[model samples]
Target: MTPGGRASTAAPAEATATTITFFGGKGGVGKTTMAAASAIGLADAGWRTLVVSTDPAHSLGDAFGTELTDRPRELSENLWAAEPDAEAAVRRRVAQVTEDARSTLPREVMPAVQRHLAHAAATPGMAESALADLLMDAMERVPGEWDLLVVDSAPTGHLLRLINLPELLGPWVEGLVRQRERVASADSLVAGMVGSQERDSADDDPLLARLRERRGKLERAAERLRAEACVRLVLLPRRMVLAETERAADQLSEAGFRLGPVVLNQIPERPDPRVVEAVWRRFEPQGVLELPLAAEEPVGIERLRPLAR
Candidate 1:
């Protein structure tokens, strides 16, 4: 890889196994299409690829033209795809948090909180949090199942907010947990010194327990995302998307991630002089502009192959 587009003598392979997270500034930016094709390309190139859509819209199935359940289904030998059931996902997250909270909260409090969580879980962070949990679960559950995990992400702000969860909430969680732990320890020490015979342990510290659990989960998630090439931008070769992509690139770089590459999902095959191309496009013909206009779905992997690479 060289700035001059000339392959260096010491350059590595043309393609490396990298985690590609697809994001768009807007909904109709073809994030799903680029993600699907990228996954197919990676798989076909002899890399283990898992494509998971965090978008509630769940267009990964439509892109593949196959029945995709909430669980990961084998789209090919090396490729797997999944669209999480957001309802179930929210429930699962809320349940996990509630269960941990129940250890400390009054029994009646959980039921009330659980009812409220149903609607609150429908909010922006809720879905992303659930998806984050699913992502953490995947990394833990199947360590080596995928060499590359391609995340088909939601729209710009939401996706950025989602990925920025750990950094945004980390200090707050740490502070709250630390404060709770200190309070609990002090209360216990005071009780212990005052001759109260309550044998409360760390297990009994619900706030500390929840804090630790949540901290661990978020930390692990952040680690996984920050550890690997977490996100890959899939853009339209249009002006707005390119600007958004640049901003996203800056933010992602700031957030401490190894960005794989920037991919323009769909573009005019012809190099229209009026159209501004990405800096990387050095007078080369771009991808199809009317690609999405085609009625046919996917045209199978063979046809989509051109766009994938």
Candidate 2:
């Protein structure tokens, strides 16, 4: 055990395909530090690792002592890091939707569609949805480009919403597809009755096709998260942090997410053993990896590597 307590030396689990490990907790709990360190450890262990920060307020770049963009940048021989631009992602999604609407809807309806899209772009959770879409793209690159993908997610509430997004939106998209199918069916019947030669099939309708494709993507994303991803919450040993962590763990468990070992960060020297024991007992069955308080902030690859080990 290290001076802090017991430090877990085991690297992240090896996978035949790309496996994702997300480090998340309440704000200011050092989630980014743990995630960066874990990615570095994976890279040192011969796994090609990519660490991405999904938090709108990203500190992953700061942790690496370098700036990062939406695209991945190499930090070491086998490690890369990125802080995705949430605003840009939201704009891209809005533009895509606008283009799709233009192609499928009547010109008279375009104004209304554009207005709705504009409002949606500013609504709550829009950024999270956009970020989730970008994450899905990264997940698709998987074993071919990276052996492991470590995510430094937003604070607990936002992270939980992002995790459950696909499920929440999937059914809504499916309903839209069904509604479109019904409208198409009615149109086709009218065309048949009127002896019109220009009858459109539901399968060939651009709008319905787009909706189906979107629904399929949401389903696949959700499945990959449940099957190939694990969440490791990072928290301090304080009472409030511990209570929040417990609630977050329960929320994750209820959502059918796989929980990895919880990281107990910044354990003080000569701490009360009872507090540590209480944390252990509270998070029983799930291993607790302890990290001692560092003399200085663990920034840069060299400084972070020790914690990784």
Worst 10 residues of 2 by lDDT: 1-10
Root-mean-square deviation per candidate: 6.0, 5.6
lDDT of each: 0.66, 0.82
> Tens digits of per-residue lDDT for model 1 on 150-222?
7786555654564577778889988988787777778789888998965465668766776778777777666
TM-score of 2: 0.88
Regions of model 1 farther than 4 Å from truth: 1-17, 23-25, 108-119, 141-143, 190-200, 269-271, 276-299
Model 1 lowest lDDT segment of ten:
282-291
The candidate scoring highest on lDDT is 2
RMSD (CA, Å), candidate 2 to true, equals 5.6
TM-score of every prediction relative to native: 0.78, 0.88
